[model samples]
Target: MSLRPNPPCLNPQTPPPPQSELDNIRRYDVKAIANYYRRRPWKVLGRALEVLWSFGFFLTCLLWDQWTHQVEYYKRQRAEDLRELLTKLGPTFIKVGQALSTRPDLVRRDFLEELIKLQDQLPPFDNDLAFQLMEEQLGMKVDEAYREISAHPVAAASLGQVYRAMLFSGEEVAVKVQRPNLRPRLSLDLYLMRLGAEKFGRFLPLNLGHDLTLIVDEFGIKLFEEIDYLNEGRNAEKFAENFHGDAEVKVPCIYWQYSNQKVLTLEWIQGFKLTDIDKIRAAGLDPSNIIKIGVTSGLRQLLEHGFFHADPHPGNLFATLDGRMAYIDFGMMDQLEPGTKETIASSIVQLINKDYLALTEDFIALGFLAPNTDITPIIPALENVFGSAIGQSVQDFNFKTITDDFSELMYDYPFRVPAKFALIIRSLVTQEGLALSLDPNFKIVEVAYPYVARRLLTGESPQLRRQLIDVLFKNGKFQWQRLENMLSIARSDTKFDLLPTAQLGLQFLFSEEGLYLRRQILLALTEDDRLHTDEVQRIWGLVKDDFRPQELVNVAWNAVREFSLAGVSTILPQR
Candidate 1:
């Protein structure tokens, strides 16, 4: 049978609608359609040619590898060629390359390294054009806005250029002026890239575990957000708020009056780059301490506040003479939802405890796997990766090694790294590499453990609190081993006290809330309808010794007896 649908039937006496009526009912403009066909052909042809050239270059590289049987050499050469092509393509592709540098899952290590070298250091546009744009954007002449402005840009980036200028009030400021005619060009480029992605997906049998179109859309959104200097100004303010009163961490202040969508004025920071170890040492700053400040601040941003600076490359961070770690260029930042933060926190706890089962559950909870995915295989995978480092000192732990191992597993599993998670990983890995460059012995995990441990012990989240309760009171008895591990981690920081935690636990166990909790525990122990009498006796034994007043023990015992009288059978196993 033919699958084609029947055409619409026409009655012999019925006439079709009038031509004028049909034209009026039309949903599209014929003139616009004709204009699109007329104007778009050349542009489409040009883009197609460019894509064909890129494909040919890569295909040639692959053919060369096949002919010579030199896989690694050709791979490196291909990466270099791709980097050069991306650079020649201008700002949009450069930004895409930068984003790709962060995705180790998408690219090999060598290619990623080469892509990271794709600096957005385009030549500055005409100084007169910049001045004109500043005037147009800020509604004032450049001379009136600044007492002195640099004739040449101090730094020229892909999207904008920064000039060191002094305000009329004698305050030093960095004036960032967006490139002339950038928005239209960027918009067109992004649209073309989206079209290319769609076409590529249609033609290539690719399984990247994510939609290429969606990735391009996300990258475009991020790039557009960076294009708006006002959005960047707000991001700086938000980060400053997160680190308010922190003397060690500094965020450049934005001058709102002098700032607009196309231009930004920020406090000019006079400091050496964090990677400038010699200058930092000459300025009487300890590089190790500076690294600590950076790591600790980053941890607080990631774990405590759930907001983080996504890009902390050396150029974007500086160490001041006063030993403050100053962060600049707030164009790219990431935020973690509260639930993601909790999952990360729990994962840290599980990692510290070496609880592979719990870690597997964390992986599932974090959406790293499908809901019905069997995590048994993942548990062993994690153990294989982290087993040797389980009981090692924090100073001996290497986050990079663990990350690499996990990346290897990710290649084999059906795991998908969410964009935010990938950004977090990229930020940390970059920060760690920078820190190690300054101080070879730097261990980020060592500096981060105290904070993670303290949060698990003191966090007010009900989920965390329940986990802590389960850890301390397992099988209806206090687990001294778990308590010792918690204490050991907390004790490393002299400022963290265990007294408050102990008092809180004691208070919870003595109040009416405690009696209700005890009753619930008894009910849970008997919920299976076949309660082990010894388990009940053991719980009663602990209650008798631990309860402050005798009446509390009696109440707990009576609850157990009530459950026993119900359908729950009390079976005592033979000793």
Candidate 2:
């Protein structure tokens, strides 16, 4: 983790951007600033202020060198400052900056730490402006735009603010207002990021071989899509439609005519967030049931359907009075290539089977690790960690102990990954933290097993089965040979090191051997099915399948629907 103080290539000047890359500046709408600020002079003043503030902060950091402090004072101050500023900047800058902050490699640690502090405390936008934006977007005033609109904002986010409102058709709705002049300000920030990267490459570890210009120009285009309210409004509409029929969850209906590039109006939902324990209790709902609802919705969004909300924070979620979970914002959505989802399912299975090589390969495919990096040391490193995890299977494993060891190993020899991939890791880590907060004894693997098993049954087709068979055959043979070798070693006069080999062997056998443990799955489809099969596969192994445990519940629901209509025993008569 320590950098050589001044490595030869480290301080070299970045190569100049190609002319074609330079043309990307055109994608930025210079005039959008005028529209948002409502005057050319204010746009100029805003840019000047941004420049002055940035330079002043940089100069202060460099000159005085507040080198020592009681408790990381500078880092804390920076974070607090970022939180305040994002709140002050309305919405667009907050959103754009957050996406940047998630890239630890893109910004320095002090700033990233500070930006993360903005997570919950950014100030809400003016409700009056929210109404004005609604009028502007729909080409009518608030009274005309909706049947009823809640005066209060239910949630405020980096990109926009959400308020509960109702349309003329008697539909309750949530209206999101994009801060005025956000489009132009974010474009400037994108340019500023390029400048910072080129000028300060040594301070950051960007993608090694790519030109700074190309890297940032691509970043600009993506950020461009993010600030566009129109696109975000569309994203919301599409997701609302995707989950429209689901009863356990709802994506608010979008009011497109009342939505524009600067505003959005959708169905309003009154419910408590998943993390709002007191409110959840007040609603007379079980926290466990709410957890299940959130988990199941996330599974459906990510698995059966590839499109999903990139951020699933508590603020973006709500639990209804009757117990259904509500999803609101959709400004940032992530769509996985179909294969990536498959790789994840198989990767978990690989982890269960302890196939470190396939696990490493899957990491590469999933963008969890650097491509072309030496993975040999890593394979052993993982074996040491994953082995400890599987000695009792994922269900029985103590993740704190296992992860501490894994974290130690990773800290010792870390690998680089893309920012997008890192964000996914961040989400899982955050979710795990939330789960532990709810109950320290909670095991994500245990909770997630049902969802994984369901996906194994449904997400995978016969092609997946063929691949599963091929992979399992190799892994099983490998395990047999490994068991034989260990046995052979055990007979030797000298006791060999089974610790490492045993660990390595365990990972391989689980992922490979459990590939098609269908009978074990049927057993775990519910608590009552325990004796349906004499043999058992570890629940974690079942979780590793392309299937999700939630899918099992879905199957049950469909069966119930069938029974309500037909009165049948597709409902599993007995154990």
Candidate 3:
């Protein structure tokens, strides 16, 4: 609530009492501003220039509506321009772009594709400046700390620049040195965003949770954590620990003694980015196989383990010499709260089974939809695209298909994805595209299906299960009830207006509308006869042929059997 956060401890974590010549230099109180700004008025005026640049953002969006067609054709161009502008504007603005890039649900495929280019591409800081910052943060000169520091930064961005370096023992490492002055700039940028979101809130829509306050707060937290490389160090360590014995995935070990708020030192890993098909091939590895490993492992992290890398682009992921897949940059990791992981897992399973009702419930549980909205239309809308039955599931639907469908649908209404799980969800969805790039037949769902099935059968983290139930009841209840009502009408009435019945059943089968009704049918029928699809279809035909009894037992049996959910819940992953 205040401009300043209270120190995490009674005594703050800062440089220890100055001993060496470097440490003897005045340490700027991280909590207190340095004299540079107050001592000089020009710096204050410079901040004003930044403020104007921040306000200039509206000019771009003003043309957003006008450039509709151009936006599509020139997506890459527009996104690169935006990324450059974001970088120029600094971390707060870059943060906005980064967040938007990871949300394919809220953006178009091309747009998201273009935005990924921003992740590791900011102009590098002067190597001399980086050396100075490293010395300032580590309390030692460059030579005192490392045997050889690459003056040329291997990677650089808003908060830091990474250099390939060698420690005293000759171990090669990568060092991330924070910019000389970052906190003040970030705070100001955040201030501008806060002011902007507040101004925009007067017309903010309900579904977006359009709380600029919350968005700004989250950004602040992320930015602060980003600067504190120590936390990132821990995250990488934890991830490495998780996959310790397994050789398929490797997270670089953190060199903690040299890591601090402004400088992070870790083992430098050698590999090619996941997207570089040629390099992966040149390394005597199958790009397709590596893609498989990336997708499946990512799914396990999000839906099973509840922790994941927010950005899994090629720049942040790679295939090591031994064919081990490695993930880097823990600066942006997302942790699914209780129920989220399960909801996502269940949603995928439901989609695979073409259980619209299950997906609807899952959506509701995950808080993607309101608990009280009419789900009749959405259910049928899904079936219109995905079809209904066990084999013809949404999971069978490929990434390109989803991109096409969601792209059109999103134009009308922003397909809602919860804010907290935004990064993880988008990463998984984009992974489909990355996989398809290497091999045309690569289906992210196919790759993820085995892990999904394994988790479902073995039971997942509690968070995932909670989310599944939430979707079924919390958000999809009305649709379920409506489905129940439709079935009840068809069962009891002599005059069966079957259009409403079929449509209602279809919608209920596909999404929010029939989630509960389908669940009810499955639980009820499974209890009675183990969910015979032929029987289900036979029942459908019986409802249709009740008046015209033309010896249709065989047809009814066949249809129900074909439609019976046999092995629908069964996982099919061609691993």
Candidate 4:
């Protein structure tokens, strides 16, 4: 993908030209270009000073070996200072810090903890400038577009501020007005960031597994998309379509007539923040159910819909009075390719079944391991990490331990998380943390199991069906233990009907390969001399109960007759 500059829009009233026409357009923002050159020196100096100050503390701690005990204290202090510096640097750096908070591979836990608190809340821009931009972009006066508009912003953030307004038709809406000259400022900042990233990749001790240039380029694209209010409006519409008729989730409707490149008008959702458990409970709502709905919806986006809300923090989510999850700020969204989704679903199944070998294969398939890499070394490591949780219920499993262990393994192995996978992990971890705060006993896996199982049981994917069969059948024979575990998990959810799963299994059994599998089971039963009479009877009873088809029953009878004849001959003995 080439990184061509986006053409400047000379007239905000007209729609921006498409990518094909960008090269033909000669529009330019001379003011933005001059401003960039004027501010470049000061911005560079400020960043240098901030970096020097941050590293100065660390160097002092290192050189003064006598103050070793204070090393940790100084390290924490430096991290806090770096976070403050990023916050002070403005919108671009704040976003960078927010992205860094999600990357456990790049930073330590203390730094991550501090960086995650970097809020995007900023003081509102001048109200007059906001109103003027709205009018200029929407090609209408503020009053013509809305019946009533707040003189002050209802909420202020890094890139935009939202005002409560009523449309001309009396529909209450939220108007998000972009920060003045954000496009030019962001372009300049991202250009500098890209240069810095290239330098860091050359000098820093990091193994990113990919080009830093590409990563920065991708980040720049996403940031630019976020600043495009029309893009955000379309994202909201896509989400609304995705969740149409979903009673537990709600997406704000967009008013396109009053929206433009720099100004977005959306249905204003009146609800409490998701973290306001006390207030939610006061309104006769169950916080646990709310979290459950959020988890399920998030899982569906990842596993079923392929598109997900990448930033689902408390601020971006709300618990409405109608008991539906209202998601706002559709600026950051991630899409999972079909192949990635398949790998994820298969990984979940393998984790549930405790299939370490299959899990290793999944990692390899997902590009976490090289194709030529020997997975034998990793299998024992996986066992060491997940063995304790093998037979435990989802509620009893420790998700933190798994994540920690995985982090450790990444340090030891050739594992690198792609940007999309990283976002998915970050979103889930953040959501899980929120859910835990709401209900200490909440188990994310417990809520996600039904969805995973439903996909495996009913999905049309042949690869997934093969994985399901692999989970249920081992060594060419049906594994009752694994089957029972799956059935138990399925039964745990009252809404999940096991009939479809049973039918799927039976359909497979009656297939040609399944007939061969039946023969393998018969051979195993007949050849095992340790089987006593009672044991044989129990096995026969189980087979008869499960395999109702006459061909299967006949095969079982023949195997039993041959075994009995062999037993009599052995007892009569002469051999």
Candidate 5:
């Protein structure tokens, strides 16, 4: 793709947000909120009454359904009622419903099926107001800027709605306009929710190991980010950069000239929702392959880039005509702190290795367990919870099932998801749900393990290199099959190169960290005081087909070149 200095937009001079909208961009602050609402007691009272009334109505309907349990009929009816209630309750509750949809542990299966609809089924605001705001933010009349625009929103989401439009230049685009007065309403609901979580959270019939208030606060922060169209535009650009040359993934470009705090314009995509299996198949695309792109791309985001779209529901993802998984709505994106990504990757390795003790420590290190908390009791619980779930094959391992069991374990123990990891869990769970929609028997780990294996095999970082060693060697014994398995899996990835992997292996085998590994290799080869060349011959036999002699020579030459460059650079003066 060719780079442009400044992509033109409908409005060359988009207006900045007013003072009121600017105030909404601030971080979540409970003290400031309480103080701000102190002088507006009437507003608080009115919203509180409204919330209570809505909850009462929802509960009454649920109770009535329970009283008349007419087999499977009422069950579906109850789920529908819950979906409608959340829709009526507005965006904050809608978001909560979306989160609950991914938690098989919290919601019944039927309700989960219904709640997922909330992702894009919310009602849109007035068309007149939406168009007017689009004009006002862009500083250009709608007709003058766009040759044609949709009469109604193409899709209505919790925070905003998308309209398909065409520019005067005949370029197709998607114009996303935020709902008017969204900030104040969301802020108020979040404040009220936070207050309730602080005051009466414990009394609820819930077993989350963390403070509910913190979760509310985190949600509030992301909600604020989502409302800011400019922030989301920047997020989109960054995400695009992260997957710059990746063929399997696509991210829409932001037209900055026509975008501001409340208005966003981007490339319009003609595609099918990931859940639309029939449409996907009709388009000559394989649903399973589309899911693979989604899973692999998701893994790259969380593991490699440490930046990811936290909200990846069906509506926000689409299977493009060209077989690329396009990600939309960059709002609600999160960044993993340094080392956190490696820790997560290591946990996956530990899980596959069935080292429950190490996995328990990984949780503590990841902040799922509080410091100074005793973990002796937790290790066995984790083992028992995951052992049966991970049964014969990774292909049959379901993430939701593990989380369901994990929720019980968390309730019994002091396992709490850190605020930082809340969205991580939600994103992963939602991605898994999306995959299951396309392929019923899909296992997240089936795709995830291959990606992890590829990373472990060729990763240059010391931490990842150490993990590679950990996978290959167990209890000071060299595991030939483990090495063979990793190589087999890693080679399956398109980006995997055998020569570089072998080069890294040789480099590490001689490095300081490899001292223990070298000792193990020597011990294995000299077992019973007799040199055994069988294992070495076996590994060579496995890789000989792909590891060409020319590639080995190239690896040697490149290593020499790198070493020479390093020596020369060290002796030269600092810039």
Candidate 6:
């Protein structure tokens, strides 16, 4: 069967349903699709054949160019061809291309540059069809629902196209209408792709350490969620809730009355894309500060809230005129379990410590390795891959370079990216790419480490506190320089609490969990039973400037008063 375009069929306009009916729209469920197409053999076969016809020739051309060693000669042409082919294949392929754009290790530079155009540059579908679909979904005339709306789409993307509209209340909003026939097209393509992966894996010489079909399934699940406009609205609200009271971050409010399964209405933002460095500067905002906000917010999403916006391409992130960072397009989102979040945070520590053995364990804990897999040989490979990149100040580390090297390592070793981590890697890599686009010298680790440092120093979570202890004391010895560095970095964060940190330090120093820390401090201050004041003097010298004279007196008075009250009670309060 040869693939051909399907004109969007229009559904008859009807009256708007009640809120309860809209809420009943099917939500995202990955398990429901696991064996979803087993009975539809003919449908799967037809779609599979259509896919083969569409991509088979392209793959053949690629293999031929490689075989003749002429790939460099025709690279640009091949890239253009690949982009057009994916676009022709519809939303599913377009999404896959966008995901591939961030992977430097998987896709070459020329092809990656081309694939990036897929992010927000896809061709718009028929505007008339979009209007028809909106009316059908919202059960109201376009003019009745909006005071004014764009005659044409303001922007077009894989799953939907966006229109600028105004409410009757005089508020501006961006109305997103889903592409016609998106669900069935996506469903058919995903099944065919999964089946192809399963069948082809038996013969292909590829060893990516992960099952390709599982990756396809993961992609399908997220894509399904993305197509549901209602789910996207909920994701935006939840993201706003997580970032409540954050002055530097902005999330648009959803207009629930005008939104449903096929249409999304939210506050219209007038801002420049973070990648637009020139406009950002013209608006009197520092691009560097904007980059910091992006990286910091991304860290909070992944490490702190365990929820993250997976697709953070240039289009989805904006710099508002007021100098705050605004995030849009909440369609693609993911969450990490609490344990998974802690493991990822610990992986960062292992990378910094250059403990490849522990890092290997982290990968296993993250599901990149099987429980019974032998990691003895993988440790040295990991050390070789990450040692130099992280050996210097972590600021010298580059994500793209590391990813390229790691990709090769995955092919050679037993390393496979877990299905859940696909978007995490994509998000991190895209953020780095976005930063580099704005500033060639930008190092994501520089901005990212400060947030992590603040979390470690001031976070009250028991798990995080334990990790901090591990970072400070290793092999029964205190790492004073590490402590000093952590404090220095954390001090730069505006939210870092100086007094609370001091209190926490004292509490840890005297608590049971602080036994190891106390012993290490004692060892640092004494040698062969002779006490030395040099260590204590150096510490006081480092911290003396941080304490005001009045603050010191207050702390003294509080301690003395408590002690005196306890003594009086012991001696005289015998009743």
Per-candidate Cα lDDT values, in order, are 0.71, 0.57, 0.62, 0.71, 0.81, 0.79
Give the alpha carbon lDDT tens digit for every residue of 8-63 in model 6: 32222233453432123254334444346565677777777777897899999999
Which numbered prediction scores highest in TM-score against the true structure?
A: 5
Off by over 4 Å in 3: 1-83, 99-116, 204-207, 372-378, 385-396, 399-416, 460-575
lDDT of 1 by residue, 456-496 (tens): 67745656556666555645654445555665666677666
Ranking by TM-score: 5, 6, 4, 1, 3, 2
Question: Which residue pairs show backbone clashes in model 4?
Answer: none
- CA displacement after TM-score superposition, residue 345 of candidate 4 (Å): 1.2
User: How many angstroms is residue 257 displaced in model 1 relative to the true structure, after the best TM-score fit?
Assistant: 0.5
Candidate 3 lDDT for residue 55: 51
TM-score for each candidate, following the candidate numbering: 0.76, 0.66, 0.68, 0.78, 0.92, 0.87
- For model 2, how does the per-residue alpha-carbon lDDT over 1-575 read when each residue is reduced to its tens digit? 11112112222122223333222333454344224334445545676587668657755764454554433556666656655665565454565556555445446777776675455446676877777666655567788766676667766666666777766666666677766555455655654555567778656643333445555555555556655556676786677667766778766655556666667665667687666788788778877766666666666676567787776665667878888877766765767777776777667666766779988888887776768778988998889888877676566654445444654565555454455544455455545545554566666665454454434433244434433443444533322322222233232312233233323222322333332443334433443534423223433232234345675555444434433332333223336
Candidate 5 lDDT (Cα, 0 to 1): 0.81
Provide the RMSD of all predictions against the true structure, rounded to 1 decimal.
14.0, 14.8, 13.8, 9.5, 4.0, 7.1
- Lowest summed lDDT across 10 adjacent residues in model 6 is found at 1-10
Q: Model 6 reaches what TM-score against the true structure?
A: 0.87
Error (Å) of candidate 3 at residue 567 is 30
41: Cα error in model 5, Å: 1.2
Per-residue C-alpha lDDT of model 3 across residues 194-263, encoded as one tens digit per residue: 6567777656654443465665666666667777677787788777766666658878867765677678
Candidates 2 and 4 compared: the better one by lDDT is 4
Query: Model 1, residue 153: displacement in angstroms?
Result: 1.2
| Candidate 6 to native Cα RMSD, angstroms | 7.1
lDDT of 5 at 255: 75
- Candidate 6, backbone clash total: 0
